[model samples]
Target: MCKNIQLLNDDFLQDPYRDYAHVREECPVYWHEATAYWWLTRYDDVHFALRQPQFKSARLHALFDGIAPERLSRFTPLTRLLESRLLLTDGANHQRLRSLISTAFAPRHMDLIRPVIRQVIEDLLGEMQGRTSVEFIREFADPLPSRVITRILGLPAEHYEQFKSWTNDIYQFMGVSPVDRTTRAEIASTAAVEIERYLDRQLDDCAVGGGPNLLSVLKSASEAGERLSRTEIIANVVGLLNAGHETTTNLLGNGMYLLLTHAEQAQLLSHDRSLWPSFVEEVLRYESPVQIIARQLSEATEMHGVPLPAGANVLLFLGAANRDPRLFWQANQFDIQRQGARHLAFGFGPHFCIGAALARMITVEAFACLSKVWRSPRLAVTPRWRSYPVFRGLVDLQLHVTWQ
Candidate 1:
């Protein structure tokens, strides 16, 4: 094994697949010297790690462990909020939170939300008329999901920008390195407190003026006569807003980038409308939105002959596993027609993303609209990717398109 494998530099950030391929081949269960986290790259290792009981999901505390004492006090609200989030829970707690939240995301509920998503796509496209070159992330991708999520939560349209800003702050903290996390943690803490207060007020209103919004649905969610606590509702509502939009935004940008760069794949959609769903899956696998998910070992375990002790922090590379050549025939290629693309982009086991269906629906609708209107789409400039370690997305995708 090479000494000091530092994978967080600029080149790796811009394109990490080559590095992933190297690690998967050289050391599938390699430990990072700088970050002190075990990195898993191969498909089987990552898949097994995700499903094994030894690999626990409640690992967010490890992120805050390195902060200074005085500064850490400022993160109490953020810490509480993170711990309460459905993303970080396990076992019975995870089951309970998921059951309640799943009600709002049920198939019937998603059917009701579909028309709203389509309408939002239309409105966003309408605003982009008469422009030859457009920034996809800002003009369309970001707003489509953001608007839909805000509407789903029953928040006012004017608060959309605030919602986006706050979510970005929280995500920034999520994607930052532990050493540099103090500043991001402060920002995220403030965002957490502010959003908690905002949602608390919204929940109060939802209590009195009940509607078809998620707040109302969550407030009413019960299992075995136990309802979600106010803090639980707020924490998960914030999580939904973040997960609801961030990944979808990346999916659209990455999908469009692939289509624009590869004319053949883009043409497949023109011929077969049935390929839209598969297109979403291909984008997800080829360039996963959420690249890395962290976990802590609850007990001693061995992965690919590498001994991992209890409490070890491990980073599962979802993006890398999706492209693992062992599972995928032409893993790196973007083909919408690939069959049985068993990619773990949304993850596996009990902690799988709750908003997966909603994300797929939103991406399908947005891409369908883009395919119809953005004829002969071509990149206006080279695509620039965001520097977030956890999420993979374009900073901006400027494209030249002909309105059909």
Candidate 2:
């Protein structure tokens, strides 16, 4: 079957959900010849595709092998950093690392961080007080989690500035050719090395000092008397640091953007007050930051009536799937009253995001407080999108708001 296809455009960054909706209803699975990758639309299809463990995630190493092994050998250091953790691994290795990180994210520890979290949030708002115009992403969205992460990792707050820089650098790591990738890759790779080395020293101290933090908790993980290696701990921390904040930041930013645009939805939540959590969930379903996720096929499997051949790369268009007309009523509309928790934004099955609960809590608290206080909020300039195949959301958003 021939399906009409268009290459990913810059406009997708500004508003991708709309772009994905049209594609999902028209062409469920579209193949791009130039990119040599298949793109799948429809949320339920993506959900079922991800649920199959027979389809391997670890097969994504091809992303970096765009160059010959000899050429990429020089950039090995950078490659290693990006490919770290359970995020880059699959099967039992992924499970083991996830278990260690999950313990730190337990209900008990998240509650422990709540007060500090609120104080940090208030401190951010304090800085923005009386400013008639503010860039929400710069002032609020980007820094909140970086600040929280530094404290969670037991690093000093001053380092949050550098952490933000390093994370931003890492964010730019994808979608470059072998040469440019090599250049930017070094800076990001060097930062990853330094972070791991820094954590190594901290982990050693926690082992001896018995400090109560994420590092301390992971240090105590065991299986048949085998503790986590320094590399494994670093990988998990990198995974946590990357996962812990950035998506939440986008979720908050994207959700706020939606509410501001859809005044009725915004007003509904504003009036009810108790339904903020549902609103957050709907925002995630409506316009997820992670628009696409791809897994390489290790064996033959069928999805959406197409057989995924062995060694084929399959892309799950999460945004498309979320807006699937078959699964959601008025799927394209942003409805706060939408029921069910079947959205794949946080993923599903084994690779589901471990920080979902923490993310939801932050969004609820931040939006509730901002809604109550901020007098007027409007888009300062049109939010921009990244020029990459992945990560569909605003790269730079300027929202002007006033809080008297």
Candidate 3:
């Protein structure tokens, strides 16, 4: 094993799969500094940790250590708000609420909205007209995710700016300095309150048989003796919006970045579009939008032959898992045509991203629109990625595109 390795360096930050390769080869599950969380690197370890019911999510108020109790207490209401959602809830609450809400995301229902999603992507791409080159991140990725998520909540297009602002606040993690975190947390709470109120109003309207949006879907869920509370409904609404927006945005951005870098792969897929699905899967495996998720030991659990005592906090490194060489030889190689593309990008087991299908469809269509509109795009600025233990993504990257 290499001595005194640090996972939070420039090399790891720029292309973490390299670090994943090292750790998976040497120490599959080694403790790490920086965050001081037990880190899992090998593919099997991460997949097993996520599947094990002994590990639980709705974690410490502060993802970082040494947070004050008083400050942590302030996060309780918000944590409760977070925990009410499907990802945070476990066992029965998770199964029940998810079983009901899962209907909203039924494959047939998602297919119903494909045309709308396609239209939204084309419209967003159309807005990039007149320019031979544009920053694909701003022109394409950002607007595409924001608009699609807004449509999903059935929020009016006029209110999308509010949703955009709210998403920005929620997506903040280790990228911000210590001093800025408090203010960002405050903004997140306030935004959560406002958005929930908007959802509450919509739910109330749907209760009066108003319309058949997601709100109405939740209303029907409640009336069908599912016993969902107002808080639960609010939690689901905010959680979906927060979950869908930036992660999908970054997926679009990073996927584009990857394709733009690998010219031959891009041209190959451009010619035969049926490879789009596997191509997106490989992108998720390669440059995953969600880099990490935290879990606490609900009970004593041994992972990768290392025991995590009950109540011990651990960080599951999704980025590392995607690059585990044991899982895939030449794991660092970004090959769209490769077989067996299972990645931890959407996580695993009970907490797997419920909107994975929707997010996948959105990304596929967004890239499809881009493929139609632009022949090639060169990056203007190297991407500036946010290095948070909780989120893995680029905050911004400029692109210059050439249309045919």
Alpha carbon lDDT of each predicted model: 0.84, 0.72, 0.74
TM-score of 2: 0.90
Top candidate, metric lDDT = 1
Local lDDT at 42 for model 3: 69
lDDT of 3 by residue, 104-188 (tens): 7877667666777888887976787768657766777777766776676566678788767765565553232465566566666
Query: What's the lDDT of the predicted structure labeled candidate 3?
Result: 0.74
- Prediction 2 global C-alpha lDDT: 0.72
In Å, residue 24's CA in model 1 sits off its true spot by: 0.6
Which residue segments of model 2 deviate by more than 4 Å?
A: 1-4, 17-19, 75-84, 174-179, 207-212, 222-224, 382-386
lDDT by residue for model 1 over 1-404, one digit each (tens)?
A: 74454566778789988888888889988888787889998889899988987888887777677687777777888988888788888889888889888998987778778888988898888998878889889898888888898887777778888977987898778764665778889999999889888888877777524334888788777323656787888888888887778789999899889887888887778899989999999999999999998888999998778789998989999999999999999888888889864999999998888889999999998888777887787888998778767889999998888898
Count of backbone collisions in candidate 3: 0
| Candidate that beats the other on TM-score, 1 or 3, i.e. the better one | 1
Cα error, residue 389 of model 2, in Å, equals 4.9
Kindly report which residue pairs in candidate 3 clash with one another: none
Q: Candidate 1 — what's its lDDT? A: 0.84
The TM-score of predicted model 1 comes to 0.94
Candidate 3 residue runs with Cα over 4 Å from true position: 1-8, 60-77, 171-182, 206-212
Give per-model TM-scores.
0.94, 0.90, 0.90
